[model samples]
Target: MPSFAQILIALGAAGGALAAPFANTTAAAVTTEQRSAAQTFTGDITYYQPGLGACGETSSDSETVVALSPAQYDGNCGKTITITKDGKTATAKVVDKCPSCASGAIDVSSTVFQSLADMSVGRTQVSWSFN
Candidate 1:
Protein backbone atom coordinates (compact mmCIF):
# COMPACT_ATOMS: atom_id res chain seq x y z
CA MET A 1 0.00 0.00 0.00
CA PRO A 2 1.21 3.51 -0.76
CA SER A 3 1.95 5.93 2.01
CA PHE A 4 -0.14 9.08 2.30
CA ALA A 5 2.59 11.13 0.63
CA GLN A 6 2.83 8.62 -2.21
CA ILE A 7 -0.89 8.62 -2.81
CA LEU A 8 -0.81 12.40 -2.68
CA ILE A 9 1.72 12.60 -5.49
CA ALA A 10 0.06 9.83 -7.48
CA LEU A 11 -3.30 11.52 -7.26
CA GLY A 12 -2.06 15.11 -7.58
CA ALA A 13 -2.07 14.80 -11.32
CA ALA A 14 -5.48 13.24 -11.39
CA GLY A 15 -7.22 16.60 -11.23
CA GLY A 16 -5.32 17.92 -8.20
CA ALA A 17 -7.66 16.20 -5.76
CA LEU A 18 -7.91 12.80 -4.15
CA ALA A 19 -10.60 10.62 -5.64
CA ALA A 20 -9.90 7.19 -4.26
CA PRO A 21 -10.12 5.82 -0.73
CA PHE A 22 -7.06 4.71 1.16
CA ALA A 23 -6.63 0.99 1.63
CA ASN A 24 -5.43 1.68 5.18
CA THR A 25 -7.40 4.25 7.06
CA THR A 26 -6.90 5.91 10.44
CA ALA A 27 -8.21 8.98 12.30
CA ALA A 28 -7.48 12.71 12.50
CA ALA A 29 -8.50 16.07 14.06
CA VAL A 30 -8.32 19.06 11.72
CA THR A 31 -10.51 19.42 8.62
CA THR A 32 -12.74 21.73 6.65
CA GLU A 33 -16.49 21.31 6.61
CA GLN A 34 -19.45 23.60 6.75
CA ARG A 35 -21.01 23.58 10.18
CA SER A 36 -24.68 22.89 10.01
CA ALA A 37 -27.15 20.67 11.71
CA ALA A 38 -24.40 18.38 12.93
CA GLN A 39 -23.25 17.03 9.60
CA THR A 40 -20.84 14.14 10.00
CA PHE A 41 -18.21 13.03 7.48
CA THR A 42 -15.96 10.04 7.58
CA GLY A 43 -12.84 9.62 5.44
CA ASP A 44 -9.05 9.35 5.29
CA ILE A 45 -7.21 11.45 7.84
CA THR A 46 -3.57 12.45 7.43
CA TYR A 47 -1.12 14.87 9.01
CA TYR A 48 0.72 17.85 7.55
CA GLN A 49 3.21 20.39 8.78
CA PRO A 50 1.41 23.52 9.84
CA GLY A 51 2.38 27.11 9.12
CA LEU A 52 0.74 30.28 7.91
CA GLY A 53 -2.43 28.77 6.53
CA ALA A 54 -5.37 29.70 4.40
CA CYS A 55 -7.14 31.01 7.43
CA GLY A 56 -4.24 33.38 8.06
CA GLU A 57 -3.28 31.48 11.16
CA THR A 58 0.19 30.26 11.90
CA SER A 59 0.13 26.98 13.72
CA SER A 60 2.87 24.71 14.92
CA ASP A 61 3.07 20.97 14.41
CA SER A 62 2.23 20.51 18.06
CA GLU A 63 -0.94 22.49 17.74
CA THR A 64 -4.34 20.94 17.38
CA VAL A 65 -5.06 22.23 13.93
CA VAL A 66 -6.31 20.87 10.61
CA ALA A 67 -7.00 21.54 6.97
CA LEU A 68 -9.84 20.75 4.68
CA SER A 69 -10.08 20.21 0.94
CA PRO A 70 -10.14 23.29 -1.25
CA ALA A 71 -13.83 22.86 -1.88
CA GLN A 72 -14.58 23.00 1.81
CA TYR A 73 -11.94 25.48 2.95
CA ASP A 74 -13.28 28.92 2.22
CA GLY A 75 -16.51 28.58 4.06
CA ASN A 76 -15.31 26.67 7.07
CA CYS A 77 -12.05 28.55 7.57
CA GLY A 78 -12.20 29.27 11.27
CA LYS A 79 -14.55 26.59 12.44
CA THR A 80 -13.94 23.94 15.04
CA ILE A 81 -14.59 20.26 14.53
CA THR A 82 -14.64 17.15 16.68
CA ILE A 83 -12.67 14.22 15.31
CA THR A 84 -13.01 10.58 16.32
CA LYS A 85 -10.76 7.64 15.65
CA ASP A 86 -10.88 4.18 17.19
CA GLY A 87 -12.97 5.52 20.04
CA LYS A 88 -10.46 8.30 20.74
CA THR A 89 -11.90 11.73 20.23
CA ALA A 90 -10.47 15.26 20.08
CA THR A 91 -11.38 18.68 18.84
CA ALA A 92 -9.35 20.69 16.35
CA LYS A 93 -9.51 23.98 14.54
CA VAL A 94 -9.68 24.40 10.79
CA VAL A 95 -6.62 26.43 9.92
CA ASP A 96 -5.49 25.49 6.47
CA LYS A 97 -6.54 23.98 3.18
CA CYS A 98 -5.60 20.47 2.11
CA PRO A 99 -5.10 21.01 -1.57
CA SER A 100 -4.85 17.30 -2.32
CA CYS A 101 -7.55 16.06 -0.01
CA ALA A 102 -10.96 14.77 -0.94
CA SER A 103 -14.15 16.29 0.39
CA GLY A 104 -14.38 13.99 3.38
CA ALA A 105 -10.66 13.69 4.04
CA ILE A 106 -8.86 15.79 6.68
CA ASP A 107 -5.25 16.96 6.91
CA VAL A 108 -4.10 17.69 10.44
CA SER A 109 -1.19 18.69 12.61
CA SER A 110 1.10 16.39 14.58
CA THR A 111 -0.62 17.07 17.87
CA VAL A 112 -3.99 16.15 16.49
CA PHE A 113 -2.55 13.15 14.65
CA GLN A 114 -1.02 11.77 17.82
CA SER A 115 -4.29 12.19 19.62
CA LEU A 116 -5.73 9.51 17.38
CA ALA A 117 -2.74 7.32 16.44
CA ASP A 118 0.98 7.22 16.34
CA MET A 119 2.51 9.63 13.84
CA SER A 120 4.28 6.65 12.30
CA VAL A 121 0.89 5.41 11.16
CA GLY A 122 0.70 8.42 8.82
CA ARG A 123 -2.85 7.93 7.65
CA THR A 124 -6.17 6.83 9.09
CA GLN A 125 -9.92 7.21 8.74
CA VAL A 126 -11.90 9.54 10.98
CA SER A 127 -15.37 10.87 11.43
CA TRP A 128 -15.75 14.57 12.13
CA SER A 129 -18.42 17.16 12.52
CA PHE A 130 -18.64 20.81 13.47
CA ASN A 131 -18.56 21.54 17.17
Candidate 2:
Protein backbone atom coordinates (compact mmCIF):
# COMPACT_ATOMS: atom_id res chain seq x y z
CA MET A 1 0.00 0.00 0.00
CA PRO A 2 3.02 2.32 0.43
CA SER A 3 4.46 4.35 -2.42
CA PHE A 4 8.08 3.58 -3.44
CA ALA A 5 9.08 7.20 -2.76
CA GLN A 6 7.63 7.14 0.75
CA ILE A 7 9.41 3.91 1.59
CA LEU A 8 12.75 5.30 0.45
CA ILE A 9 12.27 8.46 2.47
CA ALA A 10 11.46 6.49 5.64
CA LEU A 11 14.51 4.29 5.21
CA GLY A 12 16.72 7.30 4.62
CA ALA A 13 15.54 8.90 7.83
CA ALA A 14 16.21 5.74 9.81
CA GLY A 15 19.71 5.40 8.38
CA GLY A 16 20.50 9.04 9.09
CA ALA A 17 19.37 8.64 12.71
CA LEU A 18 21.54 5.59 13.17
CA ALA A 19 24.58 7.48 11.94
CA ALA A 20 24.01 10.44 14.25
CA PRO A 21 26.43 10.65 17.11
CA PHE A 22 24.96 9.77 20.53
CA ALA A 23 21.47 9.98 19.08
CA ASN A 24 20.41 7.06 21.23
CA THR A 25 21.94 8.41 24.42
CA THR A 26 20.65 10.77 27.07
CA ALA A 27 22.93 13.24 28.81
CA ALA A 28 26.61 12.57 28.36
CA ALA A 29 28.75 12.22 31.47
CA VAL A 30 31.40 14.87 32.04
CA THR A 31 34.81 13.34 32.54
CA THR A 32 36.76 13.98 35.74
CA GLU A 33 39.52 15.55 33.74
CA GLN A 34 37.12 18.10 32.32
CA ARG A 35 35.83 18.88 35.77
CA SER A 36 39.29 19.35 37.26
CA ALA A 37 40.32 21.58 34.40
CA ALA A 38 37.39 23.95 34.94
CA GLN A 39 38.55 27.11 36.60
CA THR A 40 36.66 28.05 39.75
CA PHE A 41 35.20 31.56 40.06
CA THR A 42 33.82 33.23 43.15
CA GLY A 43 31.17 35.93 43.09
CA ASP A 44 27.80 37.08 44.32
CA ILE A 45 25.01 34.87 43.03
CA THR A 46 21.58 36.37 42.39
CA TYR A 47 18.24 35.23 41.00
CA TYR A 48 16.32 36.38 37.95
CA GLN A 49 13.13 35.62 36.06
CA PRO A 50 13.50 33.57 32.89
CA GLY A 51 12.20 33.81 29.37
CA LEU A 52 13.95 34.32 26.05
CA GLY A 53 17.67 34.32 26.80
CA ALA A 54 20.68 36.03 25.32
CA CYS A 55 21.73 32.61 24.04
CA GLY A 56 18.57 32.57 21.89
CA GLU A 57 16.73 30.05 24.03
CA THR A 58 13.49 30.35 25.99
CA SER A 59 13.64 28.91 29.49
CA SER A 60 11.53 28.73 32.63
CA ASP A 61 12.40 30.15 36.00
CA SER A 62 11.65 26.72 37.46
CA GLU A 63 14.43 25.13 35.46
CA THR A 64 18.04 25.00 36.54
CA VAL A 65 19.39 27.81 34.37
CA VAL A 66 22.04 30.46 34.82
CA ALA A 67 23.05 33.79 33.30
CA LEU A 68 26.76 34.40 33.12
CA SER A 69 28.49 37.75 32.70
CA PRO A 70 29.38 38.82 29.17
CA ALA A 71 32.96 37.96 29.99
CA GLN A 72 32.03 34.34 30.68
CA TYR A 73 28.98 33.95 28.46
CA ASP A 74 30.47 34.05 25.00
CA GLY A 75 31.24 30.66 23.50
CA ASN A 76 29.75 28.94 26.58
CA CYS A 77 26.13 28.77 25.66
CA GLY A 78 24.51 25.47 26.64
CA LYS A 79 27.51 24.47 28.71
CA THR A 80 26.82 23.15 32.19
CA ILE A 81 28.20 24.80 35.30
CA THR A 82 28.41 23.72 38.91
CA ILE A 83 27.53 26.30 41.58
CA THR A 84 28.27 26.07 45.29
CA LYS A 85 26.95 28.05 48.23
CA ASP A 86 27.67 27.16 51.85
CA GLY A 87 28.52 23.60 50.80
CA LYS A 88 25.30 23.24 48.79
CA THR A 89 25.81 22.55 45.12
CA ALA A 90 23.54 22.80 42.09
CA THR A 91 24.30 22.24 38.44
CA ALA A 92 22.70 24.55 35.90
CA LYS A 93 23.04 25.19 32.21
CA VAL A 94 24.39 28.50 31.00
CA VAL A 95 21.39 29.87 29.17
CA ASP A 96 21.57 33.66 29.36
CA LYS A 97 23.78 36.71 29.75
CA CYS A 98 23.92 38.94 32.83
CA PRO A 99 24.80 42.38 31.65
CA SER A 100 24.68 43.76 35.19
CA CYS A 101 26.65 40.99 36.81
CA ALA A 102 30.23 41.65 37.77
CA SER A 103 33.07 39.86 35.99
CA GLY A 104 32.87 36.73 38.11
CA ALA A 105 29.27 36.98 39.36
CA ILE A 106 26.38 35.12 37.74
CA ASP A 107 22.60 35.40 37.63
CA VAL A 108 20.63 32.21 38.04
CA SER A 109 17.03 31.21 37.76
CA SER A 110 14.89 31.44 40.86
CA THR A 111 14.84 27.67 40.96
CA VAL A 112 18.62 27.43 41.09
CA PHE A 113 18.88 30.07 43.80
CA GLN A 114 16.16 28.52 45.92
CA SER A 115 17.79 25.14 45.74
CA LEU A 116 21.01 26.41 47.36
CA ALA A 117 19.79 29.20 49.63
CA ASP A 118 16.58 30.64 50.95
CA MET A 119 14.89 33.28 48.81
CA SER A 120 14.89 35.55 51.86
CA VAL A 121 18.63 35.73 51.58
CA GLY A 122 18.15 37.53 48.24
CA ARG A 123 21.79 37.27 47.21
CA THR A 124 24.62 35.10 48.44
CA GLN A 125 28.26 34.37 47.87
CA VAL A 126 28.90 31.43 45.63
CA SER A 127 31.74 29.72 43.84
CA TRP A 128 31.15 28.08 40.50
CA SER A 129 32.95 26.40 37.62
CA PHE A 130 32.13 25.11 34.20
CA ASN A 131 31.43 21.40 34.10
Candidate 3:
Protein backbone atom coordinates (compact mmCIF):
# COMPACT_ATOMS: atom_id res chain seq x y z
CA MET A 1 0.00 0.00 0.00
CA PRO A 2 1.25 3.49 -0.74
CA SER A 3 1.79 5.97 2.08
CA PHE A 4 -0.58 9.00 2.32
CA ALA A 5 2.18 11.35 1.12
CA GLN A 6 2.97 9.03 -1.78
CA ILE A 7 -0.68 8.89 -2.81
CA LEU A 8 -0.91 12.72 -2.71
CA ILE A 9 2.20 13.05 -4.82
CA ALA A 10 0.90 10.61 -7.42
CA LEU A 11 -2.42 12.44 -7.61
CA GLY A 12 -0.64 15.73 -7.95
CA ALA A 13 1.46 14.35 -10.81
CA ALA A 14 -1.62 13.05 -12.60
CA GLY A 15 -3.45 16.30 -12.09
CA GLY A 16 -0.53 18.19 -13.53
CA ALA A 17 -0.46 15.92 -16.55
CA LEU A 18 -4.16 16.46 -17.17
CA ALA A 19 -3.78 20.20 -16.72
CA ALA A 20 -0.95 20.38 -19.24
CA PRO A 21 -3.21 19.69 -22.19
CA PHE A 22 -5.69 22.32 -21.05
CA ALA A 23 -2.91 24.84 -20.62
CA ASN A 24 -1.69 24.18 -24.13
CA THR A 25 -5.21 24.43 -25.52
CA THR A 26 -5.75 27.75 -23.76
CA ALA A 27 -2.55 29.14 -25.20
CA ALA A 28 -3.56 28.05 -28.70
CA ALA A 29 -6.97 29.64 -28.27
CA VAL A 30 -5.34 32.92 -27.29
CA THR A 31 -3.07 32.79 -30.33
CA THR A 32 -5.96 32.10 -32.67
CA GLU A 33 -7.92 34.97 -31.18
CA GLN A 34 -5.00 37.26 -31.72
CA ARG A 35 -4.68 36.20 -35.34
CA SER A 36 -8.18 36.80 -36.64
CA ALA A 37 -10.60 38.09 -34.09
CA ALA A 38 -13.36 40.43 -35.30
CA GLN A 39 -13.64 43.82 -33.65
CA THR A 40 -16.69 46.10 -33.65
CA PHE A 41 -17.09 49.52 -32.13
CA THR A 42 -18.60 52.94 -32.55
CA GLY A 43 -16.34 55.83 -33.40
CA ASP A 44 -15.99 59.21 -35.02
CA ILE A 45 -15.59 59.18 -38.78
CA THR A 46 -13.92 61.76 -40.99
CA TYR A 47 -12.80 61.89 -44.58
CA TYR A 48 -9.51 62.70 -46.22
CA GLN A 49 -8.31 63.35 -49.77
CA PRO A 50 -7.19 60.43 -51.94
CA GLY A 51 -3.45 60.53 -52.27
CA LEU A 52 -0.54 58.99 -50.43
CA GLY A 53 -1.98 56.88 -47.66
CA ALA A 54 -0.11 56.07 -44.49
CA CYS A 55 0.05 52.42 -45.48
CA GLY A 56 2.32 53.36 -48.37
CA GLU A 57 -0.46 52.95 -50.89
CA THR A 58 -1.55 55.55 -53.41
CA SER A 59 -5.29 55.67 -53.28
CA SER A 60 -7.56 57.33 -55.79
CA ASP A 61 -10.61 59.41 -55.14
CA SER A 62 -12.81 56.49 -56.10
CA GLU A 63 -11.00 53.96 -53.95
CA THR A 64 -12.46 53.13 -50.61
CA VAL A 65 -9.57 53.47 -48.21
CA VAL A 66 -9.53 54.09 -44.49
CA ALA A 67 -7.00 55.14 -41.88
CA LEU A 68 -7.00 53.78 -38.38
CA SER A 69 -5.18 54.76 -35.24
CA PRO A 70 -1.60 53.56 -34.95
CA ALA A 71 -2.50 50.90 -32.46
CA GLN A 72 -5.32 49.53 -34.59
CA TYR A 73 -3.20 49.81 -37.73
CA ASP A 74 -0.37 47.62 -36.40
CA GLY A 75 -2.10 44.33 -37.19
CA ASN A 76 -4.87 45.56 -39.47
CA CYS A 77 -3.16 47.02 -42.49
CA GLY A 78 -4.84 45.86 -45.73
CA LYS A 79 -7.85 44.58 -43.84
CA THR A 80 -11.38 45.56 -44.88
CA ILE A 81 -13.73 47.34 -42.58
CA THR A 82 -17.48 47.83 -42.87
CA ILE A 83 -18.61 51.19 -41.61
CA THR A 84 -22.23 52.07 -40.97
CA LYS A 85 -23.83 55.32 -40.01
CA ASP A 86 -27.36 56.55 -39.97
CA GLY A 87 -28.88 54.29 -42.63
CA LYS A 88 -25.86 53.89 -44.84
CA THR A 89 -22.99 51.42 -44.90
CA ALA A 90 -19.73 51.20 -46.80
CA THR A 91 -16.78 48.84 -46.89
CA ALA A 92 -13.28 50.24 -47.10
CA LYS A 93 -9.76 48.88 -46.98
CA VAL A 94 -7.35 49.89 -44.26
CA VAL A 95 -4.73 51.91 -46.06
CA ASP A 96 -3.18 54.28 -43.58
CA LYS A 97 -2.46 55.20 -39.98
CA CYS A 98 -4.24 58.12 -38.35
CA PRO A 99 -1.85 59.46 -35.75
CA SER A 100 -4.31 62.13 -34.68
CA CYS A 101 -7.33 59.87 -34.53
CA ALA A 102 -8.75 59.10 -31.15
CA SER A 103 -8.80 55.53 -29.93
CA GLY A 104 -12.11 54.83 -31.65
CA ALA A 105 -11.89 57.17 -34.62
CA ILE A 106 -11.28 56.10 -38.22
CA ASP A 107 -10.46 58.40 -41.12
CA VAL A 108 -11.74 57.23 -44.47
CA SER A 109 -11.28 58.47 -47.98
CA SER A 110 -13.83 60.91 -49.33
CA THR A 111 -15.34 58.23 -51.50
CA VAL A 112 -15.97 55.90 -48.61
CA PHE A 113 -17.17 58.64 -46.32
CA GLN A 114 -19.58 59.88 -48.93
CA SER A 115 -20.98 56.40 -49.33
CA LEU A 116 -22.01 56.44 -45.69
CA ALA A 117 -22.82 60.12 -45.29
CA ASP A 118 -22.70 63.32 -47.25
CA MET A 119 -19.37 65.15 -47.16
CA SER A 120 -21.21 68.14 -45.71
CA VAL A 121 -21.62 66.18 -42.53
CA GLY A 122 -17.84 66.39 -42.12
CA ARG A 123 -17.84 64.14 -39.12
CA THR A 124 -20.38 61.65 -37.95
CA GLN A 125 -20.95 58.84 -35.52
CA VAL A 126 -20.14 55.52 -37.09
CA SER A 127 -20.14 51.87 -36.18
CA TRP A 128 -17.45 49.76 -37.80
CA SER A 129 -16.20 46.22 -37.82
CA PHE A 130 -13.09 44.40 -39.00
CA ASN A 131 -11.98 40.79 -38.89
- Predicted model with the maximum lDDT: 2
Where model 1 places Cα greater than 4 Å from the true spot, the runs are 1-35
Would you list the C-alpha lDDT of every candidate in the order shown? 0.83, 0.89, 0.86
Residue pairs in steric clash, candidate 2?
Answer: none
Rank by TM-score (best first):
3, 2, 1
lDDT by residue for model 1 over 1-131, one digit each (tens)? 88999988777877444433332222212221123426888888999899999899899998899999775677787889999998999899999999999988999988898989998889989999877
Global lDDT of model 2: 0.89
Error of 1 at 54 (Å): 0.6
Point out where model 3 deviates above 4 Å: 1-36
Query: How do all models score by TM-score?
Result: 0.70, 0.71, 0.73
Give the winner by lDDT: 1 or 3: 3
Tens-digit lDDT string for candidate 3 (34-65): 66456677789998876887778898878989
Encode model 2's per-residue lDDT on 9-101: one tens digit a residue.
999999898867564342233454456447899899999998999999999998999999977888889999999988899999999999999
Clash count, candidate 1: 5
